[model samples]
Target: MSRGKTASALDLPRPDTLDAGKQQGAYEALRGAILNRQLPAGSRLPSTRSLAERWLVSRGTLEAAFDRLHSEGYVQRVAGSGTRVCAVIPEQFIAAPLAREIPRRPVAPDQPDAGVQSHVPFVARRPDASLFDLKTWARCISRGLLTVGPGVLEAAHPAGLPELRAQIADYLRSYRGMQCEADEVIVTTGIRHALDLIARSVLKPGDTACVEDPGYLPARRLFALAGAHIHAIPVTADGLDTAQLPEAARLAYVTPAHQAPLGMTLSVSRRLALLDWAARADAWVVEDDYDSEYNYNTAPLAALKSLDSGDRVIYCGSFNKNLFPGLRVGFMVVPNVLRRSMLRTLQLTGHSVGASDQLGLVEFLRSGAFVRHLRASRQAYQARRDALLECLGGHCTVSGQQAGLHFVLWLPPGVEEGDFCSRAAAVGLTLQPLGKFCHALALPPAVIIGYTALTLAQIRFHGRALAQLL
Candidate 1:
């Protein structure tokens, strides 16, 4: 470890006094100081020339140490000047948010967005206003117009593009092992639309639907918006806890392929129980097989619909995760008995996603590009997940990595996930608090780290910074 590079010792911690093992120690210590705001954001660091002289270490050693710090996000480079502490370290990362998690009033669903309740403006989400596959899609769209009748473009089927429906069926049979036909597939904008359709199609405004308590927020919101009373069922390490499901609900929305936030696959036992309960209760099961594309474990699990001999499950799939988020095409395989009602619901809701995009996507699927792209993306996302695990392993206990685009980390009890994330962001890291996914008042503090959108190097870099914030 004796000065691996030509760089000299870093400034602060007086490098000359430290032994080989201690360089790492000094590097970490300084990183903490910057995040803790002791060094103060934007403050210039002593030059390598100055640090070498002060610490009595060779220039090579000091430079290497600074590179480590820079990668970890504590240090930054300026064009004209030398290295500086990153400007605008979030006040809450090291410092606590002034507000408490619990308020005197009950947190209502209709309450204004939480951002409005805080001193800080809402932290904008990562820009996904546009997705990456638009160019390939545009060509397909043009080709679709050439192939289909003018009448296909004239009126919208709330059920979505028919050609897309047919293609979705073919793709599912080839890929996911679902025995569905075109008529069974109800195409919608994406996962959210799938949720809205099921919620609206099945239950009355006041009827209850069992949902994972610590679950996808959009599912809870969509059901609530549709006037269904949401029953928050607990989700365990093996997916949603079917035993915890109450007797009242007539519908249940699930991510059986891989549970969100917790990355657990529904065990064979739980899947059976879930299906049986739905059948016995005469209830609807909306299966959101959202991220089966990026499975890092064994092969992807079959959708609940695939196992539904009783025909209780309505399974949904989409290209959002396989391609990009805004592809705006997803299909559902509802029970044949409910087809008319589901289609009627789709029509009433105006969930038409235009036929052109669907046809282009169908063509993309038929060409075998969709499968090939998934194979490539699977490797890419798995590598990113590995980087996230490796970089953050020494800092936090990581969880939920078997499948899907993101994973969850349980912050220590006294720690505040949101507060740490804000601080980390000031230094250019974007980690969402785990608690952000929770719907309950007494939710545990955690953060959901999404790795699909970033490169492995980026994951290592930003994840290291986020680890420091933790």
Candidate 2:
């Protein structure tokens, strides 16, 4: 276990830990050293001769460990230089550990394959920033600074700026088909902030909260953190199965516009049924309108909030995707009766949105620039979606293609999502598994392909490589 004078700073496996067998023991030790930064990235490894001598093993044994690390991308070998830690560690290596695994369940999509990383092509759901017109946006910011009154300098409403709220209310009415007033719109950061506020204000510890199975993972984790008993409702093609809802559930989170991971719009009948169920169960519905702006094949459906005759819906919307993600601005329309309580809650918690950003966003929406940006981004996204579907559909079963930035591609037979993703990573493809979205229940093996951030050329190029893998 002691370090030899000639050995590199990289921690070698203790001889006792080698009971598992030399290669595995060496691999685990070296991997841990890289991950924990004991062997900082790009640090050169000790000469194989020196390391072998220190470990009291043959040079071939150390080389075997080095070969494994090189193949898995933990380290690289230069033409003249010896092996060194990879300069950019892969994403899979850094993916947050699974918080909890439901016992006896199969491998889920979305789990990061340890040691897999960014030599893989772009696979994340982040919006493409290339299309954003920095010039126009800067002008909008300048306009906001010039036109926004001195009143904006004062301590603002915790909910958000009045002007921005009014603009959002109008935008929702026109685009999302929701009826609401400025007062009902409580602007927060993004979906996370909106949900945090809702969870804090409404969910009591141990209260049952219904979440869509194979749904947004972060939302489920948030609910768990708030001490709600998560009731995972299965998502069918129609959306969250209303018939499967638990009666005791007091809060339900849904992505009705385009279901997360699965692209199906919540059917009108199912939306109404969900609303009715919420009313009957006395539950509040948190409708996450995350990516409602990019409907391609059909006219966008009315939001679930639009059908809330009982005022049971808390409508959430975000500009991060459609505008720019860094904007960190989104709004929620609560029932008039709930507005005061929500505002009070925000004030108490001090979850304030930046006033300058709010003012700039107000100008962006008011100046018609936001709409123009949406129209352009929508067209570009639709093209990318079509290109990706065209590239991938023949090789695999693709679903949820009607809208949204991403869709599900069912894994080929006998290839589980996790294994497929791991294999994909090795060949420079980053794959998101559908399994990671599941909680207590299981879904068919699939991978989510995000088209928005990638170009048509990149999609076609990577798509062919992926098809060969399948």
Candidate 3:
């Protein structure tokens, strides 16, 4: 019995006049007919023998053309049903309308800085990839593959794999001093993913979201996209100024462990004050604990979530910076009240990270390789930071060097920030101006210099070059 409606005869061009070979010509004709809608989806073509005889081509040639079409998803072949045009064409072959321009949202100024190549010296937030123990990670991945069973292959929980979430919660409890269980932890692609979930779950259009001024611009832009009115609150050396927090804010996004670009630890008093404010105002606090593992001068502070007696803070952290950016595994610990909403948001959005990678991370953490890596990375980054500081001594003032991967280099009085960055660029140096992180708050002239990704020699060379420029 015919499985699909038979297609009408196609007036395909002869292979003899068209391009190189008979098989190629046959494939092109069929593909063109399908795309042009002459041969609509679910319509079966004539048997290979009949089509070959009709086109005056060998049966083998016609079969080969059908094989190509099937491989490329243009057609589907069944044992008794024969070849039918696919229900959907590949997206690339679908011609988009030329008449209308796709609407686009305006990109925020703080969207990833342009022209900063990862290989260039002083590129911020990048880890030293060379230091990663690839062999160990490979072994972990192998073990993870062996553990995959029928359960692992099934539709994963939108919150993530339970084993991986448990591992992350344990790690955070031990290192970040947060009291959390596996159920409280939701696996995400990274901090951005976590923030996106938080914004969607909690915010209504026009709700006020307070973000740190001279802060992480991506966070501000994301909240704005969620239809929240962004209120840029000033950030002092002590971190976000709690005194200026909006009375009606629905959420406050902060980088408390190590402030983004500025690298200040949120003071204990301010952390308490911020939490207090959130409790009173019924607002949520998002703590992006990015790069808190690399502190050199002092012991890493407890995560802001640890101090949340009111359970108002949503703590976020990512392995992307500590391991490698490509890892793309992060987790968030939300309050019990918000978990249902967060999970609902995830279910609606169909957010699921790769199970294999999550399992591999579970192995990585269980084997204690992650802790060993962090210890080694901390020492290496500290050494590189010291080397760069030594080379820049007496040339300029530097701050925010006690922790994190980057520090702020203040321009000498009367030295314009733009001119300094332009001069650096002329010499093939990439410098991120402090002005780029600022919105409403005006800061002194400076540039953010990253050291973790650079080797001691690169740091010394670039540090000297920057000094000479000064």
Candidate 4:
């Protein structure tokens, strides 16, 4: 055949020079053809004898080229089927190099920034790790390890361990006034994980979800990820404005016991109104009782679930705040209507809290040690809160100090929220602006200050410094 005819049939150039290592040249020619799709996927190559004669190279060189292609996953070879290009090329699936202008989804303006775990003063929602009772927790962990047997060797219950569930049930009944059994409790990594599971189980694309205007930012993002149309309802001094709840919403998320950034409890009337709205709208309510364990003046109020006569509430709480953040154990007291669906979701997703951690929590709840620890934590936090309050001494307005780990400091008329936080950071003081938590509703300038992670001395010093800055 003529040179042009041979090249056309093979769709590859002939090896330039046999003395320059014909095997390498042949390999390059075939590889280039495959990469450029001149030799399409699954197309058979010519027999080694015929191809060698056509290219004027020895058959051994052609075989060596084929062998290299096969080894690199560029082609497939079978004794009876001959050699063919691979159906899927290995090089085609490699990720492209990073570019400055790659597309990205918009992040929530209120999303927490990096270095959340850093020990910065006045950083909200952080607990004091130094207060954790390590020796007692270590003993409980050892006891928990013994509880694991051959039954859990294959798989753990998707919902959670039975013993841990029962202990959690008892604790909720006594402490939070929630009426739930072991079967109704679904263990999770934390509040965020619980919300994710609930969102997956119930929310459908384009469904409507009502969230507080200055709400938990993560929950809003989760619902949005599920493709729900988020409706930010205004929060008044009483809590979420119940009258503004949409009639067509499929879910309503609230931090009723203590509003997140605002720190106001939902009044009893509004609580009933919310349950009534859920029932009327045929929607599910997610109650995030994130940090109700440390009410300063009065006893912590009963959870919204306790008032959920219509069975519309899904109560979520986490040990991350009460015990330690690293524990990563949380639970949801779901309504009976959602028990099966939540369990099925858990099973399909294959997510379960660590069995050892669950069992250790069970031990912690059983030994009366958890209660003692809470007592100590409350006393320490209360002292810090008082010290900080005394230091501020009418320097600026403070609210939400009645409960939870953080309180809001309302900025004076001339102070800008962003500028105040920036000034605070310049002095090595970390702060969270209240505007960060707002979605659609505009509010007066303010900052959320956390005291639980700081000692009394630190709180006094920082509080005085904040007053001076103000």
Candidate 5:
């Protein structure tokens, strides 16, 4: 019998079985393994030496098989990292996999209680509402009530409560290095509302708007709602790639302080180039200055709005990051030239925020309580982040350590991101996949590990669990 026929007896495909050649037979077997998810996304293959031995084939045959898979986009050969299965499997192969469903990992009895609606597993961007100072918050509400007058109760400027605006302006100046005055500040429910206002004021139907590729999804969805053409630009190690920005976009939205998911601060050089692009193109830049206050490593870079020379930047910030999201309060600082028109748009739409909530936040800002809360929260989150890093050592690579509530954890080759997350969720720990954040780009398989809301004990426990799963 031929040597190839001898290999066939071992369940390896014989070289003579197909018209394409020996390489084709090997490819089919490997492809079947991939399609069956026996080798899941981000999983590394055995070395050619090992695979050749297992299949009773030569090393050259295995190499040829790998080359074909790489060419077809079923796998990737990252520099320094070995070959890994693509997170987005090729469409043709995907149909076969859909024939069978991936079974859900059964939840164990010892699992922690996932909220009725929320399956968050120590997720990112979530602040701990339990830590809130109830006494101080109540006192602020009482102060607003006692001091409430007819003027405050009746129709007032759509720009927001004058006191709250002034407080925000002062806070921005001291903390973010933005040199705006009270007239520049406009109160909104949160960043989404702020972006909606910007879209209404600046963007028109068919106007192009640029956003980061693997970015905040809600922002991208908001741009789509405004009838604008959305462009997904790639985010680099530093931050958003300003060079990839279209020269004719009407507006661009970015998170510079702590980039949305990647967490890298926009470099000074990129910031300059972005502002230059905005100025020369006559475009508006929305600086979503979210979560800059919780930086743990270096003092944060000065905000992007601080570098704007042409008054082209619209600065948006929120108390939600430092406090809680349910507060539904945020503020935007528009350029003086655009402030009047933006306010008019807001007024016409009747987007006036609640008077009591504004007054309560105003008190929170004035009484030094906000800064105190920030200081304490920063320390607590830092501890959680440190605990995660400690447990994560040697298991996977973690990035975006400088700021924000969460960081990206890139699993090593041979580990499957989806499978890892499923096992985690089965144990009552819900982890978010990084692929969900991408629009027009494919990122290395990863998960965003948020540490802000989790305590050290929780971090250590979950982190250990995650490490074991890896």
Candidate 6:
């Protein structure tokens, strides 16, 4: 306290008087000011003499501080610009180090029907459109249009059409091993919308959650935006490694049924172990049963929700794999207790599934069209998965091939995921590096290729191309 006068912040003494501490403190203060946009990108710093005078520091000390900033690329010495801030920083600028930064959860965005074809020559994700029975689908849509009396195209019932819910419930029971009532099914636009709703409703700012590293980036972004602290767990060949689980997280989001980018089922033992962990940790598990319909071999593992003794699992699935991605129809099976709140959320968000589309889906399911579609897509996707594996030969081993639309090619030790992806794209085929999915760890290098949209022929073509490229 300076007598009766309020102490001015700028006039405060240099508390970090030690040489090393003072230099580090100066760097941090200036960096914060620049990052917060207080100092615009091109702004110049005060002269050494001026800064020394203002901060009551020796000229040599001020010069040393400036030199540190310059070496760190935070400031530049231009011919006439007088040491202005760098116009662009490096990619690693301000990026938190793996051990120092809080882990971020990765979440995929809600995909719009319009953008499904945005990246043309798109060879990502599951779907054999050429093999799809478009005539059958057209017939169904036409029948629905003819059957509608009036206002069928109007706004929908907020809770969704009862018929569609019943259909989805039956399908889940028969295929997904879900023991849920129709009333508990809430059809969402996709997983993105469902995740956002769940985060907004169930999680509060600063609540901790766990996500798979080298997992879905969209989930990570969503959880981070909601202000939750994310714990990044690694996904292995048999889904996420629960042994490395972080204890403090209150919730976890996973794609256990079929790990994304690297298609692998959660082993039965790991499934139970993960559920047990959740029970012990008192955390909620959001099981994204992604690409469940596109399994390669015979009977896959049962849904994680199938083993939920506690009302802790929130299950989500989409027809993006089984049917066309443009369908944009995914269902979230909530626990009975959360059903009403979930429905109310859908209503409040005005994201009620379309009545006509839902009715059409009802017709499709009851007529067994959906199952037929699933079976057909399964056979086609399984073929592509095989082709890609066959193409890999002995270059690099593939991971997560028992089920799901895509798999990862764990590259040679020297090859970084980013460099491989960039170099491959330079040669014409777009590939996603596995490292992009990592949140807070030094991710292993691997290329994740999706075989869903590509045909067996395209897979072979790219396989040879990739062989040469790799």
Best by lDDT: 4
TM-score, cand. 1? 0.69
C-alpha TM-score for every candidate: 0.69, 0.73, 0.77, 0.75, 0.73, 0.71
In angstroms, give how far residue 273 of model 1 lies from its true place.
0.3
Query: Hey, what RMSD does candidate 1 come out at?
Result: 22.1
Ranking by lDDT: 4, 3, 5, 2, 6, 1
Model 4 scores a TM of: 0.75
Task: State residue 25's C-alpha deviation in candidate 1, in Å.
Answer: 77
- Per-residue accuracy of model 2 over 1-470 as CA lDDT, tens digit each: 32322446665645555576877777777777788887888898886787777777778887898899999899997655778899877756678667798588686779764421222354646567778888877887778877866777785687787888899999888987888889889988889988988888888899999999889978888888889998999999788898998778988999998998788888899888888888889989999999888888888888888889999999988888777667788889998777887888888888777877887788888888888988898898888777766766575788887788878888767878878888888987887788888887677788877778777788789877877787
- lDDT, each prediction: 0.72, 0.81, 0.86, 0.86, 0.82, 0.74
Lowest lDDT sum, 10 consecutive residues, model 4, at: 2-11
Clash count list over all predictions = 14, 6, 0, 0, 0, 12
- Count backbone clashes in candidate 5: 0
Stretches of candidate 5 exceeding 4 Å from the true structure: 1-119
Best by TM-score: 3
Instruction: Report the Cα RMSD per candidate.
Output: 22.1, 18.1, 7.0, 10.4, 25.9, 20.8
| Tens-digit per-residue lDDT, 294-326, candidate 4 | 899999889999988888999999999888878
Write down the RMSD of candidate 4 (Cα, Å): 10.4
Ranked by lDDT, the better of candidates 4 and 6 is: 4
Residues 399-455 of candidate 6: C-alpha lDDT, one tens digit per residue: 777777667777887887777777787777777666677777665677766777876
